[model samples]
Target: MRIDRTALTDLAQGAAFLGSGGGGDPYYSLLLGQAELARVESFELVPLDSLGDDALVVPCGWIGAPTVSVEKLPSGLEALAGLKRLERELGRPIDAVLPIEIGGGNGLAPLVSAARLGVPVVDADGMGRAFPESQMAIFNIRGLSACPSVLTAACGALTVIETDDNLTHERIARGLSVALGGIAHMVEYPLTGREAKDHAIGGSVSAAIAIGAAVRRAREGGDDPFAALYAALRDTSLYPYAGELFDGKIVDLERETQGGFSVGRVVIEGFGGSGRMELVFQNENLIARRDGDVVAMVPDLITVMDRETADSITTERLKYGQRVKIVGAAAPAMLREARALALVGPGAFGFTDAYRPIEALNGWDQG
Candidate 1:
């Protein structure tokens, strides 16, 4: 498939939703992708199954707080620099590139790199939705090595990491991001085509585009965008269930960019004396509570979006008094498995609550 300007715009919108209130905002990435579109008409998106068994596929994205990513821009050479360095280390040309996660700016990031490197992007990713740490990716959960990964900054500094521990790789990468000025681009979890097909979340790229297009078309057609978004998400195999969790105004907010992550929470009160909902985050929305009762938690996706426009409001972008709708979706089945839960469930973030499906919690299963 080819990604044209329209598709790119849809992708930006959809990726922001998939970001689950993290993965950084897609606004700048949309502009960057548009800029690239001016030079080239479209970006090539190849399916994972199309690659040869031994094809070298690299997953790439920007790392750091979404707040900083909005301010600290890339030099356009970061992805290419990282990919080239990785090629040098691997002693071969890359067959394709893919988004490390199909969420927010990270989803659009690899397009720039793929365009520059003249490689096609695989229609899949490690994380179906955004997460705070690299070790949380499905690749790591599935026992893939993240080492020999390359990190590049806008300042032309490059570092190659080689650690047996994926957690250590994330730690070193996070430190490098802060030292380099808050944000940087990374190409990690290099995969063979077979590995990508086996473990990566397939069709998420096209799914995001479809979800974005649905909302856009709904808005253009005088229909409800949020309804359209939920329908679109449910229509996709990647995100099976989705619904509005709450509709309210942000009454309070507390956010801080610390330890290479944007951590905070927002309190939202429903209209006309309705109950309140609270969301906590570490780069992405981790949990949601309604009137102090847990309604949804991590590993499931929770996103705060403009109530009227349906645009996602990331953690960094949250503001008091903003009217927003909290939306929740069931994560991909692969992420809900026992082992995967140990890596990304509510307990993984230090919550004592056991894992529960959003559908079950919200009683969506009855309908």
Candidate 2:
């Protein structure tokens, strides 16, 4: 399938929701995707099964604090340079590319690369939702090596990483992002088509597009956009359950770019005399609580969105006193497995709580 300019906004909107209040601002990447479409007409997206067993499939995205993207503009050269270098190292041309994470602006970065590099982007990704660290990617959770990765900066510098350990790769990459002025593009988890088909979350790219388009169409028809969004997510195999977790005004927010990440928390006061919902985030919203009761946690998707327009308000873009609704959705089943949870669950972020499904926590399934 081909992604055209007409579907760009929907993709951005859906991707923003999938980001769960992280993934950087969708505006910058949407603009970049638009510009690329203007030159190439449409970006090619091949199905995961279409790839041959030996085909080289690389996953790529930006890493570091989302705050940095607001001030530092990407030159659009990072991914291209990094992809070329990867090809040289592998001694094989890239058969296709996919987003390392399909949340926020990272989802669209691969389309820009595919358009420029003449390779199709697979309809899959390593992270079903955005994660703060490299080790959180399903690639690492599935025992895939993160080595032979390429990190590229906007200033034209490039570094190749090779290590037997994924956690070490994350530390080195995080350090480099800090040293490189807080953000850079990364092409990691070099996978053969067979490995990608076996591990990567399938149909996520199309799922994001569908969610966005559903919201847009609903808004245009004067229907409830959130209803459309929830319905769209339920229709997808990856994110099967969706609902609003809380509705309120942003009463408090604390955020900082620390250790190459945007770390912060937000407090939302419910309308009238209702209690508050608090969300702690590391790039992506990790854990959420309502009236001190644990309502949602990591691996599950949590998003703060504009109440009226249903626009996603990412972590870096959040502000005090913004009227918003907090939403939650169950993560893909693959990410909820025992193996995946050990790496991406609350404990992965140093939380002591055991992982709980968003649907179960909220009793969404009972009704």
lDDT of 1 at 320: 90
Model 1 residue runs over 4 Å out of place are: none
lDDT of 1: 0.92
Worst 10 residues of 2 by lDDT: 2-11
Candidate 2 lDDT tens digits, 221-322: 999999999999999999889999999999999999999999999999999969999999999999999999889998999999999999999999999999
Clashes by residue pair, model 1: none
Per-residue error (Å), model 2, residue 149: 0.6
Q: What's the TM for model 1?
A: 0.99
- What clash pairs does model 2 have? none
**Model 1 C-alpha lDDT per residue in residues 1-367, reported as the tens digit of each score:** 9999999999999999999998889988889899999999899998878988899999989889888987887898899999999999999999999999998889888898899999999899888999999999999999999978999999999999999999999999999999999999999999999889999999999999999999999999999999999999999998888999999999999999899989988999999979999999999999999999888998999999999999988788999999999999999999999999999999989999998999999998788
